[model samples]
Target chain A: MSSPPRDAPGAGVLRAAFAVARKELGESFRDRQTLLYTFVLPLCMYPAMFWIMVQGVLVVQGQKQARDVTVGVVATAETAEAARGQLALDEEGRGRIEVVALDPETPRDADAIAELIEGEEADALLFLPDGRSEDDPAALFFDSTSSQSETARGRVVSALEGWTEELRAEAAEARELDPEVLEPILIQTRKINPSKDDGALVLSLLLPILLVVMCVLGAFFPAVDLTAGEKERQTAETTLLLPIPRLGLHLGKIFAVCATSMIAATLNLLALGLSAGHLLGQLAGLGDGAPKVELPLGALISIAPLAALFAFFVSAVLTGVASLAASFKEGQALLGPVQMLFMLPAMATNLPGMELTATTAWIPVVNVSLAFRGLLVGSASAGPLLLCAFSLTVAALFAIWFSVRLLSSEEVSLSSETISMTRILRILRPR
Target chain B: MTDPTNTSAIRAEGLAKTFHDPQRGVVEAVKGVDLDCRKGEIFGLLGPNGAGKTTTLRMLSTILAPTAGRALIDGVDVAEDPLEVRRRLGFLSGSTGLYPRLTGRETLRYFGRLHGLEGERLEAAIARAFDAFDLHAFGDGRCEALSTGQKQRVSIARAVLHDPPVLILDEPTTGLDIMASSDMIQFIESRREAGTCVLFSTHILSEAERLCDRIGIVYDGRMLAAGSLDELRAMTGKEWLEEIFRELVQRADAGEGAA
Candidate 1:
């Protein structure tokens, strides 16, 4: 066969890099451990964990609501009558609360109230002083430590608030005034962007941080395998002897790692976003008015480039750091702290008022987080987003440069010495 | 300095390397080594452990840069143009490992692409390699599942996938069984007949004696002597290559003490 056509000088390196990436990715897909971390776990873990949590909460709440409680009334005949009328309208309904009519001459004291609860005569005691009027404050005494007492107190409070509102409206009617006069200042809320989905707002708050973390996690194992794993398996020297520049090999590993990380992040978001509506609806006990949790396709498309850039940055940094270690276990130990550097900046999205700004767009992981959040919420400006993309591109390039330089050094790449900070510093020092 | 016009496929002069150890300060791994091998020549570097044979070969392969002097591969300066030098050379060591997840054929394809071979040309080269090495039976199986001899054959196939003119093997038969070792020796001899220059380091004296056209004995990071077997035997007044090696080492040690 005749020789293959030659590529232009620059394209040759790129082609070699792509070849390396293809091999790494193909190998990773075959490894059970890498597949578990990159694809299988993300696809299953989020949905399973959310389901267990939501079911647990619903079970506990159902059990709490199923229990019954009794309350004793100690007051004058007039007040007792009024109290019984209001207590019958308990928000939990009459069957949940059994009203025990105590003697009208019963003492209104702490000892009596405590005995009512502690002796099981009632779960709580409602005490209204003699000659108490509608304006006079009444006391419901219950044990805060007892679940039954707390449940009873909750029901009684709801019933009494309803009774008080009725009394206030009656007083207003007697004075020949509108009941609206009772509440002078009523505040109303409206969304500034009415078209923005409420579910998208919730997802924006959550998905950005999750995406950042998943990206880091997705890059974690592959980076270790491609770099330190090569040394441990004794393939580093053979790979280095290939007729391509070290930069091509470094970029190839980074591309493979970036692809895995982006896939993981995307899969995790899909699982969570799809299940969120059902999980939240169960939590809120809203059957029909549950907000539909959907990832807006436009927002997702807009944020994808930033996410990919961020994944590249993360993959490059991790692969570079992992190359300093001589084995996989040591690579993991060294990278534990480095992973935190990306995590802390990603949590910038959790800050109450944090958003993409000119200054924030220049920050590395922080910019990615804020940009994702803003894009999801339909609040992102193109200027800051462009700046964020530029910043991430620079960071990714620098990471590639650093990794190429590190992998090129014979002391770091070829030596079997144990990794240490001093040694890494020495290797990084200008020759 | 290297002579661009020389037909030597492998050449080195006064190659040296030093490393820094936190406890030992500056450690000279390879003090100074000189070598020359022509096309179709089989040169063996015979040394004991820590004798700097591996380090010297590493420098010559362009895997590690020499702290002093220079080397050339097929007339290309190793340090000045390592990519071109690598393209012209094939390097293998006992420590060189294969990707366990890849099949034998995939591993060949990967290296072929790195050498700028693609499409039908790459496939044809891979097929020829498989046929030549008798690797068809297990070529589609993962390398991790292959036996020691089989992995060695695949590794050799990978090293020569691009048919480099110069070959470097460092203790290539170190972990092989007797049968595997014999197969490796036969492969090295075959390369000689193909007009490929072969440079290898080994501590096994008999293997070197059987295969090398010229042998260099290195001791404590220095080349004590280099010559054909008969020339060494005559120089040391010894019959066996082992006795000649011992005589040269003793002479070097006695020379060091007198200094």
Candidate 2:
């Protein structure tokens, strides 16, 4: 009898690895928990969260606008008329201010003003001496403890400032001078990259942290399931008995985990991208003038390689760390702290002046975050970006190597040995 | 080097394993033990719990490496070329679990692919496994939804999917009902008839007596005596296998006490 044809050595190993990955992905898709975490949550969570936030802000703003306040104007009859006109209502007519004339004999003192405020006769008191010069500042008093008083104080101060500006302009016109000459320094801001999308800026600031978190989360469950879950289910021995190399099996699991992480990140980015413009508009009160939140497809495409490498690195690290555990719950306990390690570094991008640089490009999660931000904002340089990618590649390769070694150990694969720092250190050390 | 002419499908020489625990210091789980099983033979490993039967079988199946001596699966050195040895051997334990999310058919296909079977050949093997295990009734259902007996059948199908020459089953009938246990025994007998070398461990003396062509009794990680039922009875001058086992264990204990 003739024997079947055999694949070349490398081809056979690769085929087995691919088969393992395919099986894992199939199982993951079938698992309801994995599906919920990987796809549905990311798709719905950002939009729902943003919607709730936008609605909350709008509700609070509406409530604040609908409130009205009374202000006592302790001013001369002539100035009182001007104050009435100035403080009648806010520009949108949403904030109404009732201007009441105080008794002419009323004392112009803090105690008297406090008495009027406390008596509920007025929410705020504005005192303007009859004979005060134009240069004399107006005294406005209101109780900070009361929201009405705070609102009245804001209206009166705003009206008085407008009144002062008008008075200054009149004074300047009477002196035969142009009001514009009063301000010599007019700061006009300009952007070097005017084409930089507002959406991209928001994404740059926001996506990095979200990407790191989502990527970690995406890899988290699968890594635990494939390793510790397998052990707990007593399937680890079955997998270990396969004729393939341990490295192949490890690689297959990592590939499946990386795919899930990337899918989650992409879905999160898509959800955030779709909703960020409208959400930011509502939150910033820009309304109709909100900048269109266009995803920087170019930057996204460019950063794909880095994102993939980061996912691979995270998957490998999670897989190896989780494998130390003998049960699914134990894996979660071990990985929960490890997640903070990735998250805190990604958050470093939110710090002001934090950017991708020679030093930062070597840092793991921070480098990827800053790089993603820079790429989106059109600020990334090729040299540092390349360095960052190289560093991640090396780290990812190292993580894969370490994970394969860990999986290859019989004690780890077969025994429910108590995890220890010494054992971990031993694994980390070269054999 | 292994002799190609040797009929032994499973062979071990002084196979041993030791574990290092932080609190317990050094502990030897399997002291030097030796065994041989020829093709078309059923060798039963009889031992009490914690007697190192599982550990020994693990070494021969290439799941755990032997810390001392050597093991060979179908003439392939276990430690030297574990992957090749694995290809020649099918290993199953009571605890060998199936993927809960995968259907039985999918699980078979996965194992088949891992064993380098694919395309038409893979499908053919999977079909045959499904038929052989009477799994068609529930093959499409997720393993998590299957009954215990059904899952065991699927696990057995998975082990034998690669058509390996040497089969190492560690307490295959453990946790099974009377009917399931009988089915498992019948399957082991079938494998022996098909010229597959079967080495299984069981603490159930009745099972060893009923199914094993040659029984090797193990105690405290040491093999006490190995022979056919008649040879063992004659050696111990006992009529029943249970009495023979007790006599052998008592003698080993006496020897240890004297030492």
Interface root-mean-square deviation for each candidate? 3.8, 3.2
Candidate 1 residue A333 C-alpha distance from true site, Å: 1.6
lDDT of each: 0.84, 0.84
* Per-residue alpha-carbon lDDT of candidate 1 for residues A1-431, written as tens digits (9 for 90 to 100): 11122341214667667878888999988978789877787778778888999999988777777777888887777777787878875344234667787886666677867876898999998877764467644678889999889988988888878887988899899999999999998889855543336678878888888889999999999998998888888988888887777677778888999998998888888878778877876776665455556756777788898999899889988988998888989989988999999898887678899999999999998999999889888889999999999999999888887787777777778667655778778777887
Error of 2 at B93 (Å): 1.7
lDDT of 1 at A34: 82
Q: Write the per-residue lDDT of candidate 2 for residues B21-123, one digit (tens) a residue.
A: 7788888888888899998899999989998999999889888889999888788899898877777788888764889989999888877777778799899
Which numbered prediction scores highest in TM-score against the true structure? Answer: 2
What DockQ does each listed candidate score?
Answer: 0.50, 0.53
Deviation from native of the Cα of residue A399 in model 1, angstroms: 2.4
CA shift of A427, model 2, Å = 2.7
lDDT per residue as tens, model 1, B24-130: 88989888788889888999999899999989998998888999988888888888988778877889887548899999999998888777777898999999999
Docking tier of model 1: it is: medium
